[model samples]
Structures are given as structure tokens and as C-alpha cells.
Target: MKVNCPTCQSEVEWSAESPFRPFCSKRCQLIDLGEWAAEEKRIPAQATQEELERALPDIEEIEAMLAQQGDSFFRDH
Candidate 1:
């Protein structure tokens, strides 16, 4: 089978002996999670339309808080 590394986007060969079969390496695996945690990449919710309508305000508030603290919380430099 074949898979691509989530981080480097390199081609990954799958085999029993390949420990980093899915992610390319431990670092790459963690990088993907970091992307998720930092919201650098987005994941869609399974909520219905009505739920999303009700959730927009909450999401906005969360984004506002993140914007306020994000520079301090996740500093790149």
C-alpha cells in the first residue's frame, strides 16, 4: 500500500517493518497534531445546519479569545 507523509508530504511506503509508515517519522506525526491543535488546519464538524447556526456565536467567541491570546500562547519567534 501507499500513503503520504502528513508533514513533509513525501511519499510513504507501507510495510510491516516501516515504523513511520503513515507519517514518515515521529516528528512528522507530531507536526500533524500540532497543525490541528493550533488550528493551522481545519477539521469539519459533523453538526447539522441548525446546530451550526446556533454555534456560530460560540465559535466566534472562541476565535476572539484565541486571537487575543494566540500570539502569546503560540509564539513562532
Candidate 2:
């Protein structure tokens, strides 16, 4: 099977012989990695309600936890 490299659009043999099967070469692979690292590429989606809830603690919950901990949280053990 063959597929175009995602990074360079070069034809690539989809096999073990092609280590970078989806990319033309290490350079192309790195370019794609860099783009992703730089946030140039991303999967578009909205966070689900469950996802949003799990993303962070509620403000009241945070305050309660902080009150429970008092100033001990600021001290080093």
C-alpha cells in the first residue's frame, strides 16, 4: 500500500521498510511535530459538560478545601 506523507505530500510506501510511513522523512516528521507543538494543528471540538466539570474544581469546592487546609498548605513539610 502507498499513501502521501501527511507533512510533505510525498508518496510513501506504507510498510516497515518506510520507518516514517506517514511522513516522507525525519525532517518532514519533525516539521509536523513542530507544527503540532506550536499549536498550528489541532482537533476541533467543544468540551463536553462532563469534560468541563472534570477540567477543574468548582470555586466553592476550592475555597472549602483551602479553608480546611488553612495556612498549612502554604508551609513546606
TM-score of each: 0.42, 0.46
List the candidate 2 regions with Cα displacement exceeding 4 Å: 38-77
lDDT against the true structure, per candidate, is 0.50, 0.50
Model 1 sits at a Cα RMSD from the real structure of 11.4
lDDT of 2: 0.50
Could you tally the backbone clashes for each prediction?
A: 0, 0
Candidate 1 regions with alpha-carbon error over 4 angstroms: 39-77
Range of the 10 consecutive residues with the lowest summed lDDT in candidate 1? 40-49
TM-score of 2: 0.46
- Model 1 score (lDDT): 0.50
- Write candidate 2's Cα lDDT for 3-63 as tens digits: 9877556689999878876775654444444443335333123433344334433434444
